[model samples]
Every structure is written in structure tokens, then in C-alpha cells.
Target: MGKVGPPITGLPVMPSDLPLDEVPEDVLREVLEEEKRIYRNRSYKKKPYPTSRDVMEAVREALRVSTRIHPDEFPDVVLHILESKGFEVRHVTVKRIWRAYETLVRKGVIRDELGVMM
Candidate 1:
């Protein structure tokens, strides 16, 4: 009877080490061309910055949905929601939103109750 042995695990065989500069010229040219093609097809997209109106709307929405959330945590939550919505809102933009909210409250456009704007 043949001796039993552990089953072979077909792990991926890595390519043998070969420095790029030492590779054949044809293969190196093909690699460089592939890299260039990949770079050409890549998207360098940027998120659009939210306008003042967008910021105000987001802040209002955040306030409406955050009744159970603490007032001190509102800014971070609002920033996250806005960013997830594809708005390029930053930490500074949170301050802008707060200022806008304050203005709205001062002008009686929005009512403030216990730090949560309504």
C-alpha cells in the first residue's frame, strides 16, 4: 500500500523575482504601455462643493432627523451625511453651516429649542 500524505494546497505560485530594469526590452515596453493605458483610463474625479443653500438644506435635514442625537454631535453627523451625499463639505464647512443656522434662527426663519434648530 502507498503511504498516505497530506493533500497538496494549490496556493498561487508567485512570479520569480526579476528587477524591472533587467527584464527584456520587449516585456518592459509592454508593461510600460499597459501602465500608461491604465493611467489614461483612470478617473481623477473630484466631489462638487456644496453651495450655501445646499449647506442650509443639509443642516435643516440633519436637525430634523437628529432629535435623539446630542446637539454637540450634530456637526460631525451633518458633515458625514453631506459627504456621503457627494458634497465636499469640510470641517470649516460645518462652521459655515452653523453660522447659516444661527442666521436663520435670528431672522425667525427657523425656531431654536434647547440647541436643536426646528
Candidate 2:
């Protein structure tokens, strides 16, 4: 009878101890590309994340509710007040809020000092 080898353990596991350079170039590139794609998608999703329209609405509501306090008195404070007013504060990111203020000021929708637009 022919000599038989001992039963083999399921497929040999890749040793993590081995240096990465030994891995094939194609394998390495595939892994790197996968990671790059994930990052790229994440960034793309975040681009234009905060829209100007949402900020405008938030500013409008904030000012409308806080009639006694001026919008220019404390911008950040007004933001918190607006949030408490039940406005979707998440839509009003810092960048968006700033843009909204700039647009309102430019278009004369709201004044910087008068507290309300003319």
C-alpha cells in the first residue's frame, strides 16, 4: 500500500507576521483602491452638505420668534433660540447660517442693526 500523508488541516492560513511587500502588486493595488473609493464616496456625500435655502428659513423663523431681541445682537444665541423654536437646526450648519445672513443682508431681507428688514 502506498504511504499516505497525515490529514491536512483546512487550507493554510496566511501568516500576518509576513512582510506586506511580499504580497502581489495587483492585490495591494486592489486593497488601496477599495480604501480610496470608500473615502471618496464619503467626501462626495458631504459636498454641498448644507444648503442655503434651509439657512434662510431658519434665520427667518429665528428672527420672527425673537422679535424683542435683535438678530444682530447675538447670532449664535439666535441660532439656539431658533432650535428651541422647533426649527430643524441640523439643516442650519455654521456655514449655511453664515451664508444665509450674508444673503439676507445683501438682498435687504434683514438688516444688520435694525433687527428687521425695511
Candidate 3:
């Protein structure tokens, strides 16, 4: 009777001492395919900066309040309001947030309380 052992998965096992040039074509093809799959998936899943709608709403609110208070210093006013509200606001962050707010307003995705001319 044959000894029952671990099920064979049919995957090729590369010898540690085997040089890259000596690797079998099928095993090399499998490795390349896996790498390509990983690369494609990595790119698909990679998001450098994901926009947060909550933050966008907060920015719009800040804009509305700031427009009433001081229209010229929208970014600064937004920064102040967000900071006072316990949000970590930076000068650059305020700029980006305000830009996103304007984009949404232009697209009519969200309403502006005071309304934006452009």
C-alpha cells in the first residue's frame, strides 16, 4: 500500500541552489504571472489621497461662515474655524480643502449657503 502524504498542489518547487537561468519555463512563467497580478492589484488598491466628504462639508460650512465674517480671507478663516473645532488644520491643508470645496460647488454636487458666483 502507498503511504498517504500531504496533497500535491502541483506547484513547482525551485531548488535553492538552482540559478535563475536554470529555472524551468513553467515555474518562471508562474512567478512572472504572479508578479504581474501583484503589480496590477497594487496599482488598483493604491490611493495616494482619498477625499473625505465630511471634511468637504466642514470646509463649505467654514466658507459660508467665513464669507459672512471676512470674505477675503476664506482660507485663513476656514483654518481658524476648523482648528477651533478640534481639526488639525494646516495652511496647505486649508488650501486643498478650500479648493475641493470650490470644485464641488462648481459641479453643483453640494449647495453653498451664501452661493458661489463661479
- Could you say which candidate leads in TM-score? 1
lDDT of 3: 0.61
lDDT for position 91 in model 2? 60
Superposed by TM-score, candidate 1 places the C-alpha of residue 45 at a distance from the truth, in angstroms, of: 3.1
Q: Backbone clashes in each candidate structure, one number apiece?
A: 0, 0, 0
TM-score for candidate 2, residues paired by index: 0.36
Q: In candidate 3, which residue ranges exceed 4 Å CA deviation?
A: 1-51, 67-71, 110-118
Worst 10 residues of 2 by lDDT: 44-53
Candidate 1: clashing pairs of residues: none
Model 1 residue 73 CA deviation in Å: 0.8
State which candidate, 1 or 3, has the greater lDDT: 1
Q: lDDT of each structure? A: 0.72, 0.62, 0.61
Model 1 misplaced regions, further than 4 Å: 1-16, 114-118
In model 2, the Cα lDDT at residue 67 comes to 61
Q: Which model is ahead, 1 or 2, in terms of lDDT? A: 1
Residue 54 displacement in candidate 1 (angstroms): 0.8
Could you tell me every candidate's TM-score relative to the true structure? 0.71, 0.36, 0.39
